[model samples]
Target: MTDPRQLAFAHRRSADQDRLQPAHHPVVIVGAGPVGLAAALGFAARGQASTVIDRKASLSDGNRAICWSKRTLEIMDRLGAAEALLDKGVTWRTGKVFLDDRLIYTFDLLPEAGHRMPAFVNLQQFLFEHYAIEAAKRTGLVDLRWQEDVTGIEPTTDGALLSITTPVGSYRILADWVIAADGARSTLRRLMGLGFEGRVFADQFLICDIHIKMDRPVERWFWFDPPFNRGRSALLHRQAGDVWRLDFQVGSEADRDAEVKPENVAKRVRAMLGEDIDFTFEWISLYRFQSRRLKRFRHGRVLFAGDAAHQMSPFGARGGNSGVQDADNLVWKLDLVLRDQAPERLLDSYDAERIPAADENLLNTTRSTDFIAPKSMASRILRDGVLALAASEPFARRLVNSGRLSVAATYDGSPLNTPDGFTAGDCPTTRPGAAALDAPLSDGWLLAALDRGFTSAWFCAEGISADALARMEAASARTTLPVKPLIVSDATACTRYGAASTPACFLFRPDGYIAARWRSIPPDAIAAALARATGR
Candidate 1:
């Protein structure tokens, strides 16, 4: 086995680069947003030539997203900058719900064992992007092009060709493939003629980012006042350095015609404070959240990611999290195809897996939003009742926490998935379509060897021979990914894991879903599974 990169180079004499350009880009990602940066990181780490271009000369305002899940932080760490970002962000252990001044229930994002950060943390979206871009820059594979926008696109049989315009002039960007992460008004998505379905809110809300100090006991809080006003005002969250993200529902009568008045928003917050709490303001704007999603994510040479694919209210942090997931799903497949290890059909799975997820997540986030709407009489009644019910009972608190927000996303019946069964490659172990349950997610590749209890190795056991392991080591010299083999020994453990019942190996995708699995390992079997899993 040769290093895929070297193998690709060697085969270059036999292969035509002209055909794959744009389609076979070293890698070209459009959008410097978090998802784009993350994709760039994944590509660079995988030994691909990557370029990231954005129409905006600078980064985002970073106002929209601020929450990071434990799993997300774990990924950032692997990319090598989680600590730097985590250190500056606020670690939220608990969030409390209140009906006006009455406290109801508090939810804690306790660490789920083997995790360094809490289940969730609140950081300014811009700040997180900064760390990611900086880390991505260090890989040196990231070619940041600000003010570089894709004005025209034409996918040829060979690859994707795009007319990218910069501050100076326009040039042709030929990529093996193109990643569309430019956001909700995605020009690429429109050009691909993909329809974004679902609905937007009829009522618009005022989004005000302010600096406020409260004498209120709660460090983080959600306030609802139903009888007083039927407008929903959410305390988006507390950000780093004590700044707060706040949203107040505006009256329908006042301002559909007029621009959102900053002073009026500030006055409303001051009025809501009731007391003379010291406060300084930062930023203010109007936002009407929509729950929109693309009917199709991939068409021919283009793939949609981030806001380009789905649109959701910033309710349960679904918008940002799901976008990252889009990146996660698309990056690996892109890596494989660019390396010439898989067929183009692998790209199709991106839509099949992610669109459904977007719909489900949109449902959950909106339901949570409705539950916490802060304005409706019914929601107010429900919030008050739940708070009082949860005050003295432990189970009730758990019910509330687990009921609305979820720690991770699970793929059900994905194109890359198979029925759950006990075999050499069952999910509870390191089998395909499975992520490690419980603590200490291995820093390297983890295989659930079911021989004695359970064991793991960085390498796969091909023929169960030392020579094979040595050969694997030799092969790895060229490839960058360490194929750690975790071999299990205990029969009881083996039987429990299903690998004992079936002798096979399974490889998981980056999102912890199984990419490929088999009763046995063969190039053809692996290739078939990879093709189906990737949807290329």
Candidate 2:
């Protein structure tokens, strides 16, 4: 087993370098979790600097979150941490669901190939934070301070006044914008008198990680009413370093403290694995969560991201993945606002986009929870009926809800999306407000071509006239924000993007979401759509 102390990342205390004093920062972030660190790195990617503070002196030792979705991996790729994460993560795409001793059905995520990242990778949250912190430090723009805590915050005419406590002494810092990423029990959200509204499930779960050499394949295995745990559900996953994560649903009547005891936990584990096998414990914990989110994510100059803004049960791996998307959505708008490129009203779109995303997560989690642990006898009977039919009937398999895996939510009615005027033959996969699809290019994947700004993919036919090419180039230049232009001529590339018609243009936002697309490249239409997208 690995020693937790040896795994701690080295972070120097800031108060020792200089005395605490009143200071001003363009942006300040509270908490140093994955979401917070991702936000700091997101700012640095856009040539913006931010100060980040955390209450702890070292990184978390526990393997809190282990599943990283493909969408989240793409975000990390842009922040310069995807390679390190991929090197240390166990990639998996298949999942098997079982009912008692019988196998029900299996599913595959991302069945097609040619994407840069996999469907999901299992890596500890601490490793994710470590790589993100390194990328942020390398940017030379982020000021990451550990062992510092925020005591209070008050909004002012120009910004927010923050009272902080450090190892040496207490001081105040002023920031034009503040990001509250302090987790579920956020101090800033509490201090602001904001409350999360949702129902708290009465069920409890026990999570344990162990070091063992097993012959099981690298795929997610979930059991409903298995022989080892006859009345409850169980889940198994493989992580890096030969470690395995096992979770068991202990009913509400079970004592939380007693369930986590080594003797009791060992008894249950021994029943699952053969008594002849040996294993060593790494970490264990008990948890109960609520599916909830704040009514408003923004309060004056302060904004909330990650757990601070919303939370849900971890059944579907939505918690960390959605939080990373939150950072991706907020950073670009915040950077533009700070640089006077967009009006302050642009920040409202952050709320408009992410709150709906949170609602979708909450909805899926609630459905998964109900299916896994049925509330009433009628619900249990219905669940068992579906499970029985799933073994033989293909139609019944669709009803199997073993956690609807997280897929990036599309902002269909977002104010930033410019409606497509051409309805005929418009591609739904690459429609406005949808996440851009990743495809293989001659050199690399399509997503690699995009930078930290708006980009236009102008697809031209094989023998386009010089006059039409000039018109397309001219239209790309007239956009409000500087947009990088890519001229795609390959038929495969055109077919993949659904740009079959000649002289088509697709505008992608900085975060890799399609802002708008046109079948024909009309300069006036492109300019107007670009203005609406950039909040002009």
Predicted candidate 1 versus true structure: per-residue lDDT over 72-107, tens digit per residue: 665566556678667877777667765455666676
RMSD (Å) of each candidate, 1 decimal: 8.7, 2.1
TM-scores for all candidates: the values are 0.77, 0.95
Worst 10 residues of 1 by lDDT: 5-14
Name model 2 segments beyond 4 Å from true.
Answer: 1-21, 460-469, 501-503
Candidate 1 TM-score over all chains jointly = 0.77
TM-score of 2: 0.95
Tens-digit per-residue lDDT, 163-232, candidate 2: 8887767778889999999998899988888988898888888898888899999999999989999978
Worst window of 10 by summed lDDT in candidate 2: 1-10
Q: What is the lDDT of residue 105 in candidate 2?
A: 81
lDDT score at residue 379, model 1, on the 0-100 scale:
64
